[model samples]
Target chain A: MANNKQYHVAVVGVTGAVGQKMLGMLEQIDFPVEKLYPLASKRSAGKTVTFKGESVEIIEATPDAFEGVDIALFSAGGSVSKQLAHEAVQRGAVVVDNTSAFRMDPEVPLVVPEVNPEDIQKHKGIIANPNCSTIQMVVALEPIRQKYGLNRVIVSTYQSVSGAGNDAVEELKDQSQALLNGEDPETNILPVKSEPNHYPIAFNALPQIDVFEDNHYTFEEMKMINETKKIMHDSELKVAATCVRLPFFYSHAESIYIEIDGDDISIEDLQNTLKDQPGVVLEDDINNQVYPTPLSAEGKTDVFVGRIRKDLDVANGFHFWVVSDNLLKGAAWNSVQIAQQLIQQPGGLK
Target chain B: MANNKQYHVAVVGVTGAVGQKMLGMLEQIDFPVEKLYPLASKRSAGKTVTFKGESVEIIEATPDAFEGVDIALFSAGGSVSKQLAHEAVQRGAVVVDNTSAFRMDPEVPLVVPEVNPEDIQKHKGIIANPNCSTIQMVVALEPIRQKYGLNRVIVSTYQSVSGAGNDAVEELKDQSQALLNGEDPETNILPVKSEPNHYPIAFNALPQIDVFEDNHYTFEEMKMINETKKIMHDSELKVAATCVRLPFFYSHAESIYIEIDGDDISIEDLQNTLKDQPGVVLEDDINNQVYPTPLSAEGKTDVFVGRIRKDLDVANGFHFWVVSDNLLKGAAWNSVQIAQQLIQQPGGLK
Candidate 1:
């Protein structure tokens, strides 16, 4: 049963935006699979999803669905993950939960494979995926943190609507078309779906990504703040984030300013360090107008980092713009990489 | 002619976006005008621009056009301002320039009436206007800086295409329309009109605004950094900025972080101080999801401040979002205000 020729994998929440992406990610990475089960809520259970050029009927994602599943990817919702992740773990499957349910839990490891693949080894049956905005940022900044000894981070995110969900993506397109036709755009899902009021994301920027916390930071902003500390294993690191939802449908961009512990690190020094990192693509040539836009980063797994320059006043401070596909590197590909790295380690399949 | 009632006024760059808004702002503020002269390039001249319910022909913006003008408001390009602003000034017209030409000139004052009405008195012949993005941020932070003793500032701007010019605005609309029709968006005037590369701004964010300077900061970003110090008269203050061109068409929004010298300043304290400021409207109620977006601040003359919260780690550090119509407060309305504020003062119109 251990390190078998091929493994049975079940995709929970197979009908969701990220869940649907997991199938393609697994195929893109060429994950060895003996059997694939697409699992969703009972309402969406009967639909078939194409995985590796074959239609696989989705089964009910109850506790019993985890039977014989060696790996389970959960993206249904927080409630679904909270209810059924333990059941999958009980059935001898490792769970990669793509929800906020267990992200801050002490028992779970929030894994971004590029930054902390080693943390996956300590996962007690469940590994949490960090938020989309947090994933791309850590991938870019972790190298800098390691080489330069990071001191502080202040990030302002320009996130895409897909980070909200598929419905929000549709809302953006519909709204754009409506506005183009001189009609009022319908607002049903943006900013937050569960929130009472919704705003149009077409040709607009919403400062609130998720709901606002008591401290006035949005839930998305706090996730970037708290998760960076936990993932970087630096409790004393000062971090602040202002997460905003922009009109794009693919990648998330960040304007990140950081203060480093190292002295006199030049832009070339930073670029040379970042270029050596495997997951980061350095696109920082200002003379040629070389930089990454969300459109340029669409559907790409690698994080694009550019606009590297020193702060005008603060000698130790540096700033850059980072962008990546929120769905790919931010969600499904990260989850797939975690699962892939999980099995590569010794005694990885418990 | 000094303090003459209903003085003759000239609108430079009358066919441009900010120029057109200048006409409306002059009317909205009800400035007493004996006659209006709309000036544009020779090609765009001869077109009638309606003002005060009558057609006003746009005269060619020549040196002789300033003959009888008491006050000339320039929004024409920088070269035009450079060539003609002084010509107008020699003809005894006080120039309120909206270009980057004279902003950094020590003799000419960079005035945001809300922040530095007194600086206008130092103007030799022309009073320079700050950049649209800088004008809005300084307006929001000046009151805070005055009350709390400011220390550091970091701003990331989400600017509209209209800040580039009317062609950029049409580029966005045409690109959005093309994108909605499932066609590739045309790119001609975005990021910078004169730059070699053009990227689609439809559903995309471009980190570059204006051309990149020698230090890798965009001209827009350097303007924010340099102008903030000059306007606040605090060269020792730490300021950094990242100016981005978003898909929005009207208002420019900024995510600003500041560290003040005062201790234990609460969000309520900041809000109380900001609300009392005349030009900044406080719209920060997190519980009800009340904050300003680009859409909400469109067509408004006031700078909107919201999402006020203190940083989690830095006791003296705080963050807020500011938005204002880039064409109005950023350019036209501000210029009109300077002119009105000028005429109200004795010995103002020389």
Candidate 2:
């Protein structure tokens, strides 16, 4: 691949929230795309999605859909990725999967380009993207980890409905409108779509994110717990998570507690380190009543951190808040950044 | 007083949300009230409240309004309590102050009947009610602390706007409806009412509960930390808090992490102890997807605990979620219960 040559890019689930954001991120980053394949289920094939003011026809995703496709961004579902990811690879396309398909697979590199760019070079045919909550948290914590060593992490998340899908977003909007009209808000898709129970997210908080595993941790919690260890490349790092779905439309907020290995690191020390990070913006100023909320972080690409303080008892313990748009930085922008970093490698993506 | 004797009660701030709930709680508990005096500010003095189907006239609260009153339940702002609480006590009525004006005072005893009923006997004139978020958490954690000694605590709260006041609840409702109608929601009462800045709480989460202190911890967060230590009677306990206000209407939910002293406590051991707690209901069955949400715990009086699991690492660490109505168990019901317990003392009101 030459630097001047353009690439053919395919976006699976082109009409979904993350997929639509992926198209916007590609254009905003000015990625040179020679062709765009808007891929979706057979039911949606005839429809079209606009890319850079040009309408691209949707293609029904199948084994043959990956022909001549240089890169495929998959966010349809875990089942969609598990089904056609290998098919895309067999047809000479690299899959940047945004599901839980191969995140823990040793052969597949799970990358957050800011934290572990070197790991991207080891991907065989597919690269895994971390969960939305995990992606923002690690980006904020990585700066601290590089300056001081990290010992333990415990996070409680306030997530938005968009992370579930575009349908979940509509469900929240409909529910809000219904409740505002003094009617009952319908619960069709939330907590987990496939699960038996559906809880309303209008003016409510659902503690369960994904289905519960044998250990009683929701799959979403386990993803944060497991993915943080993998992406930081320190399996010995201690992580615990409590993921809750709030009524917000976009951006996920987390209250995180981390114990660093620095002996006498002050709040100023931690602030300076995070302020210098590339993709992170430090919004901390308690005297000025400054901190990031879900509403303030919407449509932003960089991870926003504020509300930093040291634990009253432990000298090394610190607490902070992190927020980022789940659609862009958590899913679409993260996937695009990985692709951008991969192409910039010497000799290009091998 | 004899066992058959009835008491005279004055409901201060009678026009406020908690004051109305306090009247209901007194009736629900069938307290032996000889007379009910509904007291409020000059603006709300003409308003009337329903007690046992009777329209009780609201009296303007003043230093002299406590005459002939045996018990006073105060829920107005801290300034109101500071101005008139001693005046009420000087008028010979015992005050159960709900504001933070007297919680940390050495002479005033902070009591959560389930956690520290014994502290009620140490009060000179005023019995202080703990913060709403702290009350529910202490009830759930007290049982665990008894069976498996405790070491440290870290909490992130999803508090309701109702905890602020009736006006904040109206702000959330109006803002939510406005946004549903495709208009920008108004922001004037959230994050903090008196603070210079107000953030929208509809369809979003606000990280600041009350005003920030000099230490960068919000007043609500500091209340949780200091009040827990005072109520638990353990100054050496390590506690940290991050309080966040959400768009919910009635209940406050807390994600709490505690490091206990038990050597080999299994999940069931912790569950059994919490189930047997006097004022707590255990709702921790992940297989059936049974956990308490704000919507489910709206009108309930008991603290609902669920999602109990041992930390993946740290054999002595455990985490759980607790929810209870901010008005009922958090304020009104707790105050009424304390008054009931105070009368049950050996010689009645000392």
Candidate 3:
């Protein structure tokens, strides 16, 4: 075994949004790292990112990049992760993947550190980060799930265009300007870019996110459905999602209706559970008009949960609103938490 | 009985969003208007609006201005409508109020022409246009309700800023530009302007649309809950809403979960019913990548319905996505449809 020394960390896809967030979080948390490796595509190889007041040059992400790394954080495209994640795993690096490539794999533990930190111990070499939408949701619901067993979850997401990537953010900007100037707006990246027709996202809501699946659900919707089950490890948990992209640039808001197993769990009890839970920010104050909003939740790492109320007529039903930065808790912060756990948990790096 | 040859139309609050939409709809539908009376507050009384290529001067909306007018479309603030709607009714003008003033009044008929045009005949001098969100939902659901009795409706809305009125649209634009240019964004018009301490909406989602009620539901949500029952004329219908405003300029998207009375009603049946219904554009082709989006629904008059699918395990339960321009279907078009019904239906005119 190695002596008590800081681990050498490598961040793959350091140029992307989630990757950029991963770098920032690493600095914020001051993850004990003797050496830092920032890896991106060949195009971004020469770019420099500051870590611990030291400028580090981004290297081309390749199989050899993880040669001596003890921990690797992956947030690149799924294809890139699929190609290099296993290679890094084989090279004795614990890979915390932030892509869908390994999330559904039985062998890889899909984790929200706050919700299922125990699952992290079962990982062989690679751990998968749950979907951004799924991460915040389970973080908010798991406390309630633990207190009052969850039965069904119906969530509809008001996602920002930023979740689609940085380009969609630009598209929203250009399109909004076009709409304001009375010019014909252009759409090349919304509701699925490869899809034949692109709709103006400037003033519209698109019911479809990601591409269509064999089932009626969009890929984005299915991600929420499947990833929730995997993260919660409850195949029997009834989950349905409608993922819609709004024109906002950051953060995702979810209107979630959840049915619990217990017969008489009051809103007060649920609120108490959330208020005590880690990584959860309770923002439900009706009198002062304080509640979780996507804008207010933006740039915040904690999952903001509010609007906790029992259903009007249903006994075991409750509805709450959840908001978190899709870039943070939804993606980057989650990946970093997994890495932080890797350093602290027993046998995490062995 | 007044002659059908020409109806003297008075447009109340002629400078506002829904008010402007009402005027445009009157022109688009070409209501047989002998004289166009544009009415607003004293501040806008002398302002002129183009009606059929002719500029008509705005008049101070008072009891006297409504005299001899056959139909008056009121889209002013709720308080203004509450104060003057009866006066307009007393002046012999049939009032089609687009505010919440008389919507819950049992004496006034709450009408969505496509859903319940017959209700217009029961109007006691004033007919209430349903809430924009409620208007679109009922328009889409009425067909399904006709086929399969609706037991419960759970809707979480992704509403546009324009639904708050013209000021919100300007605020969104100005705030977004301010954010982009690294300037301090102002927030004086959203989430109830009367509330102290405003939040930015440029890249955010606000869960509260109106003032919070004691029940923890926003006034906007209550409007939806109450309006759905009133417009559907089913006081016992279980309807719940979580109204949210995204930074979109127009259109509202709703993720609606509904339980039908019959177990035999399949997703296909619901799709077919909506596809064939008037004022509904069914866009649910998931396999070929077709579905309704708020962006595509923007500027369109029809309610775009898609993502129709039966709940995975629950029988008689279905989920669908509905999108429509709040400015149009939610406000402008519904008012026009009311005007058209008043002209077309036998004894629709008071």
Cα lDDT, model 2, residue A84? 97
Query: Clashing residue pairs in candidate 3, if any?
Result: A132-A330, A204-B294, A204-B295, A205-B294, A205-B295
TM-scores for all predictions: 0.99, 0.99, 0.96
Residue pairs with colliding backbones in model 2 are none
Give me the displacement of residue B316 in model 2, in angstroms: 0.4
Candidate 1 per-residue lDDT over residues A6-120, each given as its tens digit: 7799989888889988998999878888899899988987889998889889899999999999999899889999999999999999999899999999999999988888899
On a 0 to 100 scale, what is the lDDT of residue B201 in model 1? 95
- Native interface contacts retained, candidate 1: 0.81
DockQ of each: 0.86, 0.81, 0.65
Quick one: how many clashes does candidate 1 have? Answer: 0
CA deviation > 4 Å runs, candidate 3: A1-4, B1-4
User: What is candidate 1's TM-score for chain B alone?
Assistant: 0.98
Better of 1 and 3 by lDDT: 1
The alpha-carbon lDDT assigned to residue A319 of candidate 2 equals 93
Candidate 1 ranges beyond 4 A from true positions: A1-4, B1-4
Query: Which one is best on DockQ?
Result: 1
A1-350: candidate 3 lDDT, tens digit per residue: 22365888999988888888898998898788888889999999998998878899999999998999899999888999999999998998999999999999999999998888999898898999988888889999999888889999999998888888888989988987787778999879887887887787776777778887766777788889999998888999999898888878888889999999877888788888999788999999888878988778888899999998778767888888999999999998998888887777765466
Q: What is the lDDT of residue B52 in candidate 3?
A: 92
